[model samples]
Target: MQIVTEKLLNLGVDEDKEINESQLVLLDVKEDEKSEWKALSLNKQLSDARAELFVLLNGVEDKEIQDKIIFNYKALQKFRKKENDKELIVEKEVQIQTHERGDVTIYCDGGCTPNPGKAGSGIAVYRNDKLSELWYGLYEEMGTNNTAELGALYESLLLAKKESENGNTVEIKCDSMYSINCIKTWAISWEKKGWTKKGGEIKNLEIIKLSYHLYNSIKKDITLSHIKAHAGFEGNELADRMTMYTIQEKSESFVKYDKEIIVVDILKMRA
Candidate 1:
């Protein structure tokens, strides 16, 4: 109830209206019932009344202001729906829960600039509803898009291995089903042929093998899934951006001495 009250306060339900107590009643009542509170534009009047009440109580959040200024009827309904959902939370608590054995989800991506040029890898972890961690790094030495992508999956699988526990399900999601499939099945055949395989020298055998090892260790307790990227998938795009950002930074690999290196090289060649 405290959570509900705080949220209602956050949502800006007025004290005088006793909206918390009256809302269920009002919400259940028909549109005709609100006739006593009439306006020339009844819908507008109701919308304004609701917005004004909440904005007065919720202190006019930026999102609320935009909605009011735009006067989106559906948006108003959504706010009402969200408020009702919050109220439902008041009725939804379990007094006891422990050792939840959480479900983990990871989003992985990698990319390189100039095709085979500087590259980066990203692994973003989410537990339940919110994001937990993001692992992003660049390959200053040498890397390809596929290499970085594989590396991202490797890192994500490694993290999942670390977080894996008895009976808990961990889901790894990627835009690349190719990457997912590579680690899942191609590993066994590659290992059988001494990591070289008929595929003519499995590129990045070392990390691929390590990823296989981690996957095998946690396979009994994990679930891996491939998801379409950038369909407004929050974690996927976030991880992709992290990798892309790292890729952008990869071209400027050295910080303090890159110019000095050029100057030194020029002077040395002259000598």
Candidate 2:
């Protein structure tokens, strides 16, 4: 309840008028029965009012303010669950697909605001063309877009290795050709020359090295390819959104996106 109230207040809903407005959104109540939706806006009752607002917004739609509140409420709930578990809780569908699916695809991306400011990485995983998992994090206080892209690619490699180990074919789609080349093409030559490039010192060499080794180990079962960014690919778009979310949330560690918490409209395809 405290979490709900804090989020609401943070989102600019700190007033008695706002509380009454949200309380009245309760659908379909007679004049007398509607009193049950009495506003709890007193200093002593503000907490209850905020908590009830969370519940009231559950099925309400199309109102911008209410939508934001509901979305924040769900996100906070998922964050709390993750904190309590101390582990990424794999969805039942993902767990069951281990042996049932033979193919998996992962789309990943990363970027920083102002080119070298706060950065984040995002990844979207699919099993037989269906979204199975979403992950975002790797928050860098001060980092370049390239570094963030490399971080996202490295994380995808980690996921790819796991899928390959499960006897599943994996394909990683990244929007950065620079990232794909660094691990798949350039790394081979760099490895032969003691990780040196005559041009200059390699940027993000540490992550490149880690990703290169992991990719080699899973190369037989995995393929890393480049896909154009913002080309209307649902998975890629979702991954990009996840990356932006990391910046908005300032999460330093990778967090699993709980679809049940809020619907990702971009992931839904149009016929």
Best by TM-score: 2
- lDDT of each residue in 1-271, candidate 1, tens digit only: 0212343433544444433323322233344554432222223313334444443433333555645544664567678867865653343222102224578788888877766877887766677766655556745446788888888888677656655643446888888776776779888887787776664677777777777888888888777788887787877877776676566545222111112223223223213
| Regions of model 2 farther than 4 Å from truth | 1-100, 259-271
Q: Encode model 2's per-residue lDDT on 1-271: one tens digit a residue.
A: 1432344432433333333344444322244554443333222224444555645554444477776776787688778767754554354225534545578899999989878999999988888888777888888889888999999998888778777777788899999999989988999999999999998998899999999998888888888888999897888988887878888777777767765523356454211
Cα displacement (angstroms), candidate 1, residue 220, comes to: 0.9
Error of 2 at 184 (Å): 1.0
TM-score of 1: 0.52
Error of 1 at 212 (Å): 0.9
Task: Look at candidate 1 and give me any clashing residue pairs.
Answer: 12-58
lDDT of 1: 0.59
Q: For model 2, state the Cα shift of residue 207 in Å.
A: 0.2
